[model samples]
Target: MNTIEFLLSRRSVSVKLITEPGPDDEALDRILRIATRVPDHGKLTPWRIQVLRKDGQARLGDFLAGRFTARHPDANEKQVAFERDRPQRAPLLLVVTAKVRKQHKIPELEQILSGGAVCHNILLAALAEGWAANWITEWPAYDDEVVRLLGHDPETDRILGFLYLGTAAEAPDERPRPELSDVVSRWPQTA
Candidate 1:
């Protein structure tokens, strides 16, 4: 598809519906390269990508499940299992971390936004490569323990998103979007 068509039709496929046959080593390299091509004020590439393969996903799931059980002593087996399976939903997971630098010319907010842009770019690049991708920041993204488990310094880094990448089990239907007329407006009225 062309750029315009791709931009208009692009939609996130659910992590649960994302199957195997995700991008391989070379494809992932290209995707990562594309993902970093975002607006970074001061050129301080204040972000990083951590890839979680099948084994890594399993380990993360186990860690989360253990943490959940510890935090919620009354949790049932089902709840623990749910936590354990969270990261296993996709074949590959990309953890986007925003390493905000202090005392830099660029504002912290802008650095964080750059991280967000990185997430979006990853999604678009994966889609362009005919792969289904979804960007999610669930409870783990906010959980310090989980962040540490992923080897990220929760103090200096924020988890921008957990991008799930794989083949779509089936094409996703488009959801409702804001109407341009309702959302767009020109500043400084001419009338």
Candidate 2:
């Protein structure tokens, strides 16, 4: 597909529906390289990614499960298992973090937005690499403990997204989008 066609057709496959045969080592490296090719204000490179392979996924799952149980003592085994299996839902997971530099001249908001751009770029790269991709910032993103366990200082870092990459078990349907008229506005040119 051409660039415009690809951009228009790109859709995030559901993480729950993502299956196996994800990007290989070379493909992953290429994806990572492409994912970082985003606008970084002040050239701060404020984003970081943690590739969670099998063992890392397992460890994260265990931590999430324990956290879930602590938060909901009455949660059933199925619920606990759901929390435990979130990371393993996709064949490969990436934790995109906004590592903001408070002392830098760049605004903190800009740094965070740069990290968000990285998350989007990661999804685009994975999709271009023939992998179904989804960017999610579920409960774990807001949990300080989870962030700390991921080896990041929650004070200076925040989880931007959790990118899930894998083969799609089923094609995703296009969802409804906002009308351009409703979303777009013209700012009158100043004299």
Candidate 3:
């Protein structure tokens, strides 16, 4: 599809069951480069990418399971297993982190927003490449233990968006979006 058509038609496949994403090193590099082109006020480029392959996914799942077990000694086996299997939901995952620099003239919130834009770009780029992608940030993503395990700087506030990449077993349905009239408003008067 063309660029405009791609943007308008892009939809995230939540129930991803693809056999493989097959994003080779070159293709992945291109995707990452595109993702890095997001808006940055001070050009701080406050974002980091953590690629999690299949094995890494297992490790993450194990870590989460261990964490859950430690937090609740009395938790059931099913709960523990569920935590361990969570990461296996996706074939590959990319952890997008906001590496905020506090002393910068730019506000911390803007840095976080830039990180969010990076996540969106990752999703869009994957979509444009004929891959299924979804950006997810759940409780595990916000867990301090998980962040620490991921080696993010302790002093900096961060946004953790897990971008799942894979083939789509089924085509995604386009959801309703806000109309222009509902979202946009012209300025009432000029200065």
- What is the RMSD of candidate 2? 1.7
Best by lDDT: 1
For candidate 1, write residues 1-191 as lDDT tens digits: 79999999999998888998889999999999999999999999999999999999999999999999999999999999999999989889999999999888899999999999999999999999999999999989999988888788889889999999999999998899999989998887668
RMSD of each: 1.1, 1.7, 2.5
Can you give the TM-score per candidate against the true fold? 0.96, 0.97, 0.89
Flag regions of model 3 displaced more than 4 Å: 15-19, 72-74, 189-191
Kindly indicate the candidate among 1 and 3 with the higher lDDT.
1
- Candidate 2 residues 1-191, lDDT tens each? 98899998999999878999788889999999988998898999998999988899999999999999999999999999999999999889999999999988899999999999999989999998789999999999999999999989988899999999999999998999889989987788445
Q: What is the alpha-carbon lDDT of model 3 when measured against the actual structure?
A: 0.84
lDDT of 3 at 148: 84
**Higher-ranked by TM-score: 2 or 3:** 2
Superposed by TM-score, candidate 1 places the C-alpha of residue 13 at a distance from the truth, in angstroms, of 0.5
Candidate 3 lDDT by residue in tens digits, 1-191: 68998777778888345447547788788889999999999899888999888898899999999998998999999999998988777677899988998877899899999999999999998889888888889778778888888887646856469888888887877789999989888899456
Model 2: lDDT to the true structure: 0.92
